[model samples]
Target: MSNTIVANDLRKRYGDVNAVDGVSLTVEAGEFFGILGPNGAGKTTTLEIIEGLRQADAGEISVFGQSPWPRNPALLPRMGVQLQASAFFERLTAREQLRTFGSLYGVPGRKADEMLEVVGLSDKADTQVEKLSGGQAQRLSIACALVHEPELVFLDEPTAALDPQARRNLWDVLRAINTDGRTVVLTTHYMDEAEVLCDRVAIMDHGRILRSGAPAALVRGLEAAARVSVASGVMNADEARTLPGADEVTDDEVSLTISTRDAPKVVAALAERGALEGVQIKGATLEDVFLDLTGREYRA
Candidate 1:
């Protein structure tokens, strides 16, 4: 597949801090790519530069094989961006808001209305923007970004304020469009979201990318411990610790958990002892890999 985006040695600074330091990555056509980082990790800065909303102080960026800097008009119709916080024209109904956005690209009013349905907002079409709930507003922002049907879409923290069910619904909307061949790039705080939707992901911290790869591959590369658990009454902490390869064992009233490098040995031992009730084996996950790389400390 052809590259939809290629950024090389991108750099940016604000006063004394390096917001984006020597970052470079690529996204292929029709791929669902994710950028993950904690607060103050410079993910927003990097995305803005690539989206043509801001220019990098150093290095190069190309979207659709054209420079994104200088606000290239040629690339406008082919790209769409939904920022983390979206602003809408006051007093405009949801339908009118989408219509105005589509009109900017010379898209027909009918096409804009169709996008509202695509995003499951047809019922709220006549509701004013200020009256919509947080999740509804988020979906409207996404629909506006997609109204013109751009080939490349950028969504920053699209589901940040959504509840569980709403977030999953939005995921289905994006997933369907991506399957239809649009390239999507997203930045999000939720590790599970990235793991489920992104084909590949880049973990960023301290203004630079620490690792980039497919989620499954990155998790495998971590080589972290697997956790095995069973009902608490099935095995006491002391008995579980006696299992070969058990590194640590903890027992609460509800469950008994064993952390081990050799999950097979631990599992076999549990089976042999007839202590496999409610058995659950969980290997290293994307969240584990993320925490291992960026650390467990809180970030502002």
Candidate 2:
């Protein structure tokens, strides 16, 4: 598939702060790509530059092989964006909000209603934008972005305000559109969301991308230990630590966890002792890879 977006050595500065530094990435047509990082990371800046909402101080960007800077009208018709902080027409109901946005691209009013159904906002169709709950408003913002059925969609923390069930519902909506061949570019702080939805992900921090690859590939690359847990009273920490393949052990009031390089060996040893009650084993995950690259520290 052809690349829907391409950015190279993209850099942006806000006064003395380097908001985006030497970022480079590509999104293929029909692909679900995610950008992940903590607060103040450059994901949003990088996305804005690519979406033509902002221009980078240095570097090159192309959307559908055309320059995105200077607000290319040609690109605008083919791209849809749902910003982190969404704005709606004053006093507009949910349905009106979508219809207004769809009208911008000559989309029919029926298409607006269809999008409302797709985003699970049909019941809230008559509610004013300001009156919708945070999650409902978020769904409305997403509906506006997809109302025109653009080929490429950009979602900035699309599920940030959603409750768990609403977030999962939106995931289904996004997955459906992507399956229909729409390209989706997402930025999110949720590691599990990125892992489950993205075909590939780029993890960024301090204005630069530290790693980019298929989520599972990145997790495997970490070669981190698997964790096995059971009820705390099943075994003492010292006893758990002595088990074959167990590298470390921790016992809290609720559970006893063993960190091990060999899950099968550790699990077999636990079974031999019949202390396998409530046992759960978890392997390395994308979050582990993320923290390995970006040190644990607070980011504003």
Candidate 3:
């Protein structure tokens, strides 16, 4: 696939710290990419610089093989951005807000209405922006961003504080957007969201990208194996560690967590010992991989 974005040694500095230091990555066309990091990490800074909202202190960036440095006006038309907190005129209705935004690109009213339906906001097309729910408002923000039908779209913390159902609804909308062949670059602290929505992800911390790949691939690269946990009914935790492929066993009052390279062997042994009642065989997750690479847990 052709590369849509290529950033090389991108750096940004604040008073005494480098918010983004020597970051480099490439995003392919039609790919759903995600950037994952904690607060104060360089993820947001890197994203903003790529979006051309902030100038880099050093290095180069290109979107669709053209320079985005210094915030190109022509580039703006071919890319859409939905900031963390999208603002809208309270008095304007959803349809009016989209129309106003579309006018910036010389797009007509019909385009705005079509976008509202695309984001499932058509039912409330006449509702004032201030009266819309949080999810509705965010959907409208996304609709406005797509007024020009850009090829590349950037979404920053797309589901920051919405309820479970609202978040799921937005995920569906984003998936639909991607299905139409638009490249989506997402930044979110929610690991589950990235695991579900992104085809590939880059984990960043302390102004650098620690790792980048498919979510499942990154997790599979961890040295830690799947966990085979069961209630410590009759088998001693230490004895259970002697099972084939079992590396370590952590025991509590009622349960034992077996870290095993071969879960089948450990589970069968536990079952033979009549200790499989409360067993749970769980696999590694993106959070686990991130914690292993960064030496820290990802906190929202």
Largest lDDT belongs to which candidate?
Answer: 1
TM-score, per-candidate, Cα-based:
0.99, 0.96, 0.91
Where is model 2 poorest over a 10-residue stretch in terms of lDDT? 291-300
Local lDDT at 109 for model 2:
93
- Residue-wise lDDT of candidate 3 within 1-300, one digit each (tens)? 999999999999998998998999999999999999888788888989999899999999999888887778879999999999898976999999999999999898897789998999988999999999998988998998888899999999988989899999999999998999999999998999999999999999889999999999998888568888777766787788788878888888677888988889888887777878788999899989877877765456
Which lDDT tens digits does candidate 2 get at residues 1-300? 899999999999999999999999999999999999988889999999999999899999999999988999988889889999998988999999999999999998987888898888899999999999888888888888888888999999989967898889888888987998999999999999999999999999989999999999999999999999999898888889889999999888799999999999999999999999899999999999989999888766
Q: After superposition, how far is residue 125 of candidate 2 from its true place, in Å?
A: 1.8
Model 3 regions lying over 4 Å from their true place: 231-244, 247-256, 297-300
Best by TM-score: 1
Kindly report which residue pairs in candidate 1 clash with one another.
none
> In candidate 3, residue 172 scores what lDDT?
95
lDDT of 1 by residue, 1-300 (tens): 999999999999999999999999999999999999999999999999999999999999999999988999999999989999999999999999999999999999998999998999999999999999888899999999999999999999999979999999999988988998999999999999999999999999988999999999999999999999999998789988889999999888888999999999999999999999999999999999899989999876
Give the Å shift of residue 57 in candidate 1: 0.8
Backbone collision tally, model 2: 0
In candidate 3, list every pair of residues with a backbone clash. none
Q: In candidate 2, which residue pairs clash?
A: none
